[model samples]
Target: MAKVSIVDVAKAAEVSVSTVSLVLRKKGHISQATTDRVHQAMAELGYVYNQSAANLRSQKSNVIGLLFDRLESDFSIKILKCLIRELEKQGFIAMVKTGALTADALTLAVNELKTQHVAGIILVAAGSVDGGLTPVLSAAELPYQVMANQGGLGMSDLIVCDHYSDSLTLTRFLLDLGHVSTVLFGGELHDPVFGERANGYLEAYRERGIPARKAHIIYADTDLTGQRQRLEAALRSDNSISALLCHSPAAAMIGAQSVLKLGYGVGKDFILSQQKYVTCFQEVDRLSDGVMDLSYILLPLEEMAHHAVRQLLQRLDTPEPLPGRAFSGALIR
Candidate 1:
């Protein structure tokens, strides 16, 4: 059988060849209904678009680059999956590159992506290394957007969950529940992501005219044993601390375990609250049965990824600067 061609798709869809070409290239002001018809015709005819040939003809690539500091965590994996799916739906292919979170490594990755002729890039900075990476990305002068927990120093468009609002809401909820001495657990002091959350936690106390204790803010250690030790010490130091507000699900699990090890019931003796990514709830559930008893702020990772892809595509189409997008997490008690 002859390979299906654009002419055949045009004939089947009852549109001109040029219209089919426009639809294939995602150009022109084609109506949604017409686009759907063209897609259906191509599907029925088993048409496979030759992206390489199209790129050569038009001098515009349909490949997007995804640069990541790391992809080790479940949150990163979920974001990766969402980004791939969304990019594919927009008629673009993804080229993923991961490396050490440093200026030199990021420069190498961006240069490599440029050599491949990627249309644009989406940088995923999970760690607090964006301070160094932002300068490299800006120097590259490529069309790129950032999808991370914290915004970088550059003027690039960003997509991030509203950590400050969510943290403030969660902390206030715990305080309203009569846990005035609730302690915040996890996160580094210098990291921007954690800094926003810490400010929110403190803001909640300020709103209520309650003085926040310096000792109540506990930064997480690299290991679980160290975190457990710190939490145990905090609880022992103040009998009035009847609640724990953790920065993430992992922190919450450790806090719960520590409370139990100290002969305190999780729900009865001490309240547990945490900010959880919606996508990774199942993993957390399997890791700790006590998670169900805790109050939560749910981060919508899929929604954030969808917005990031949409914004990046828009940025590619029109080289104008777009405002950064921030989404708030949902509260669950």
Candidate 2:
């Protein structure tokens, strides 16, 4: 197939090549009808824009760096996608780099983005100790913002969703359902997200005047198999565990499987509360065969991404660091 060019789009859309160029670059003012026609023509011809080539020919690049601790996390990966879309809507691109959990890894990732000529960087998991990227924020040439997961520490525009309050809400919901004995599962304590969630679970127990048993609080690895193994053991050993509070979708699904293995129903035998990212319910429904129905507290992954990108873009124009922000999420069930 011949490479589709701007000229071809111009001819198909019945406009001059210069007008097509203008529309593509978003340079000069054009009628909305013409813009729609140009877009339609491009779509009809399956024309993909060459953003890299355009950046090469231009002085300033529209690429933004997205550095994170691990690509293995579903919640973090989903946030990465939202960041890409948000930047795209603002006429920018996301250049993603993973393995920035450690100081050395962060330095290498930032250097990688610097070579790509990215305008700025967005650092996720900035407070992870086993995967901390805190020591090298201000020294880098590129401007950066941190997604302050719970107690994340950094000087840049720190964006945080209320993991503490949301976890507390999920716990309180389970308690409201008359669940006296509950287990707090998923995520290791070194990670700020899990740490905050663990605290919330304890807080809920304290508020209800119920003593939180030490054995009930289990921290598992992020992997599905590990979550299943740990949860299965917990369920097998105890029949008193009537409710579950999970920090991630993976944990919630495993909790269901473990519950079933121990001959317990999902809702009637055991109520579950989850801190869910957007669309986690669909995934749970698909994976658990629609049996893992439970209450959930919404974690605003999309909103967090939107705010993070907007903050970065604002910094690009203003070149001044903004104060950190923390957003609270709402209940879904």
Candidate 3:
């Protein structure tokens, strides 16, 4: 038995193979009568239009997969909400998945999403630029964007915070408060984002002519639990430190709790501030020294979603596809 393909359908309907493909793909370029005729011919010939095959050919999946590293982090939740609202504004729905912090986990998760035929993917590759998406995303044959922490690989487009200038501004804010001896409780400097923040902190120290003190700089984890140990160790190791520069609000909270738990007040015992992606003001109930804004970079989630949609539309237009476009974030603080 001969397999009924697009050519057979076109011959049966007295139309071009392109027309049959369009009809099967529901591109809506053909007229109603022609569409009905092609469908009728397809029914008569007992032809089953392979939807997956057609989708592969056209590369038009109206779905955008939103992936995050971890869901427990407040920053992740806030970004996800912002991204969701932005995607909805662009007339697109987001199917979100999380807990894929590792490279292997992300690869498997993205592969599973690919099976569902997503138009594209948007990922917040937090804590690490290598989200284990390189292999799968490269082979995906779809438009994808990564909101990164700088120096990310395989990001068709990247949206990152301006850590250098923002962090400098925040660190100087602590310096300006007459707090000569300060502690920098931050994440690992290996991370691009945190590395930038570290640069800013170092620049402030250089400008203030303060020698880099190893004990005053704490490489605390971004999460609260890990930070508790690091902050305690830092405070115990350094008695001259009277101020703190945290990386994120979560880090700031950990520092604050540690300051209080150590029988010291936030503003009186030690001054503090942090860098934020959206707005750190809302995250904290009170704002004192460590609450200065290092400028917020609003992620272009809506624009990214629109770009993915436009790419899908273009792929549906011609055999040759247009290249993906990258968009940058804005400093709103």
Pick by TM-score: which candidate is best? 1
Please write out the lDDT profile of model 1 over residues 1-333, one tens digit for every residue: 987888999999999999999998899999999999999999999998866335522434888899887898655788899899987766788999998777778888999998998877898877433545667876776667788766556544667767788888887787777777867887766766778888898999998989767327888868878888988898888767777777777877777777767766666334354222111111245325544566677777878887887676555446567887777878766
**Pick by lDDT: 1 or 3, better one:** 1
Clashes of each: 0, 1, 2
Could you tell me how far off, in angstroms, the CA of residue 67 lies in candidate 1 after the best superposition?
Answer: 0.7
Task: Tell me the lDDT of candidate 1.
Answer: 0.74
- TM-score rank order: 1, 2, 3
Comparing 2 with 3 on lDDT, the higher-scoring candidate is 2
1-333 in candidate 3: lDDT tens per residue? 987776888899999988887887788668999999999999999998645334434454556788887777545666677777766654466888885656678777788788888877777755456635556665666655666445455544445545666666666665675556666665775656667667877888898887777316667554657768877777766655666766666666677667656766555323244212112212344344544433334445556545544444344334553443434455343
* Better-scoring candidate (TM-score), 1 or 2: 1
Tell me the tens digit of each residue's lDDT in model 2 across 88-165.
876787787777466777788887888898878898864443324545755676566788555554444568777778
Better of 1 and 3 by TM-score: 1
**Clashing pairs for predicted structure model 2, backbone only:** 101-131
Name the 10 consecutive residues with the lowest summed lDDT in model 1: 274-283
